[model samples]
Target: MSVQSESVTDTGPEQTVGYTLHGNRYLNITNRCTLRCAFCPRFNDEWTVQEYPLRLRRDPSFEEIVLAVGNPEEYQEIVFCGLGEPTLRLYTLLEVATRLRPHARRIRINTDGLANFVYGRDVTPDMEGLIDALSISLNAQNAEIYNRHCRPKLPGSYEAMLDFVKVAREFVPDITLTAIDGLSGVNIPACKKIAQELGVKFRRRVLDVVG
Candidate 1:
């Protein structure tokens, strides 16, 4: 099911289909999300990375996405990410991942850790073999902080996110808890401790570079 790129142009969002950075390819499927963090780039900026507008004009079709991937073998990894939360397009993500698994050395999902809330069931099992790693945006060290920083759409999203991670460990082979490195009031050390407690990896991403 892996996609193979024919000699497509490497410049412009339209030509690249799935956008590329360094050597990694990213799929930009939708412009929908359940959260509106104050620092989220999609809310404030043009949402382009390296002159590639991540703000997709419309949702890409399955065929379009596969074609966008071009040659998945060219990158070290293929990631599900963009202006929107990847889980909102759950089946699409899995379908694309299934399509890319064979050609991609690694496949990762950068997510808000609310797939369970989005689909109202455990979506982790769907990714068992398709995804190589999961990067869950922890955002804050505690519920209060999460509410302030993440600004989730649903009540108890913070608790639900933690619950998502706990279950993710059972199905998703690898998980990484990440927070913006310098978000005001967010204690990076405490976030690391939370990841340590969960027995997963931790990462501190720079807010300015998230796009």
Candidate 2:
């Protein structure tokens, strides 16, 4: 089931609903998140990602998001990414992705892998055929280190995220677990090993780098 959250109206014309990076068109739907990572730009009082301001005064509607992607075929991939977790606005993400499926070469989402814990259900099935790739933030080697850096808002988030990966693979085809390399206490090799053990791919992300 989709999350029933309040709608935030777009009050101005200057709000950045979309941005382009590395041949990919990215969508900024909402600013809500399930985790407050110590290294996240927003948490550090920085709102810009690669010089594009991502502080959303209000979340965009499905129509607004669709309008932001003027030509889906112009980019290599259509990515649902911003300073926040895309899954928090799962309904809007799915609606926009579904609308762009025919024209886009690929559709991807950068997330924290906590949708199931947030929605309290197996939401991966809803991503079938709509999303082509998932880049999940693994962040740490173990729950203690994960909790220290991610500072997840919900209980059992570390375990829930792992569970999401296990279940998500059955629906989404390209799933990669990612962990930041430079953060204190973050062991890159161990993190990659966990992803290997989980039967998924892994990536080492640099601190403060978007995409």
Candidate 3:
């Protein structure tokens, strides 16, 4: 079936409510990810949140994403966020962000910070100037605990994530690294310290478990 057809027929109360493309346009770049975090519902559960379903049988192309955004001027921030990492689609993201930059006041990216490792190239440089704010998931302080919690697909991803943040800080004006409050083996204090070291803001968001 076509994407639009699937989107229309799949409509339900939950799908409509949560996934409604608010003025803050959120672009889900890819379904592929390098990490399967323990606390992330996306890891195992069906990709649905609130009334919006996160399920993606296929990844959308750049033209498709631009069309999805429709009028870029309507949104305050065109955010790159999804059930998966936006950096996985670095070229597409850059193209989309570049297209939206002139229209939207801000372009933000919510990422897992393993883009370099996943793509085997420095992804930070690509985001330069295009991204206004960078929100990365730095879920743990130490490597061992980080691996256990985030379950990154690539080796050295924990360090790679941290390094990405440090490099990203050089270009992106607002860089925030976040962690969930209640995850086991997470050292909030240490994570905060790491954020400080990287010269980025630190945030701890509460993880909500849906039935």
Candidate 4:
């Protein structure tokens, strides 16, 4: 995983927890994830998006995240995308997003679309105004394909992820379902059709482009 010309600086006790790339700021909030995708960057021995190691010593406090973010208005979008699933720390992500809401022009979350499964409830309503957009990795078209490609920790995560997207479209104004490129045998068109049926925008990314 790689990105261009990103610089890093110490933000005190939090270590190198936040990063910026492609005109967006990102937070490394947690290492917990539901799906272990065959092509996930976090599994790489030297995984990094902004050329900075994102593995955290421990999850930082709200104030620590604030200190790391500084002025959120500086970036095009404040994104909750780290080495792991951002929604694993859903409340923290929402709290931090709320505090930065005034300064941030847009807030987004790049996720695996399993928050509902993680929490055993629909969290979309809570994110309504707080999150400006969502970039959900709908890696496959169906539950069987999803389970085969992205080995989920929870058995029913594929259905849960699809359900999450279906509900989020009602609450979130901007939703984009994404499928990864460069992975053999993935039917991108099928994924796009799924997103269309789900009434969300669609995008594709090279698996190695982490940031």
* Candidate 3 off by > 4 Å: 1-23, 208-211
Between 2 and 3, whose TM-score is larger? Answer: 2
**Over 4 Å off in model 4, which ranges?**
1-14
Q: What is the TM-score of each candidate against the true structure?
A: 0.90, 0.93, 0.86, 0.91
User: What would the per-residue lDDT of candidate 4 be over residues 139-205, giving only the tens digit for each residue?
Assistant: 8877787888798989988788889999998888999999886666678999999899888999987
Which one is best on lDDT?
2
CA lDDT for candidate 1: 0.80
Report the lDDT of model 2 for residue 26: 82
Winner of 1 and 2 under lDDT: 2
RMSD of each: 4.4, 6.3, 4.7, 2.4
Candidates arranged by TM-score, highest first: 2, 4, 1, 3
- Residue pairs clashing in model 1 are 5-70, 5-71
Best by TM-score: 2
Q: lDDT scores for all predictions?
A: 0.80, 0.86, 0.74, 0.81
Better of 1 and 4 by TM-score: 4
Worst 10-residue lDDT window, candidate 1: 1-10
Q: What is candidate 2's lDDT per residue for 1-211, written digit by digit as tens?
A: 1211111212364367787777777888888899998888888888877766678888888988888787899889888987788899998899899889999999999999999999999999999999999999999999999999999999899999999999999999999999998889999999999999999999998877777
Q: Which of 2 and 4 is the better model by TM-score? A: 2
Show model 2 residue runs off by greater than 4 Å. 1-14
Instruction: Give the C-alpha lDDT of model 4.
Output: 0.81
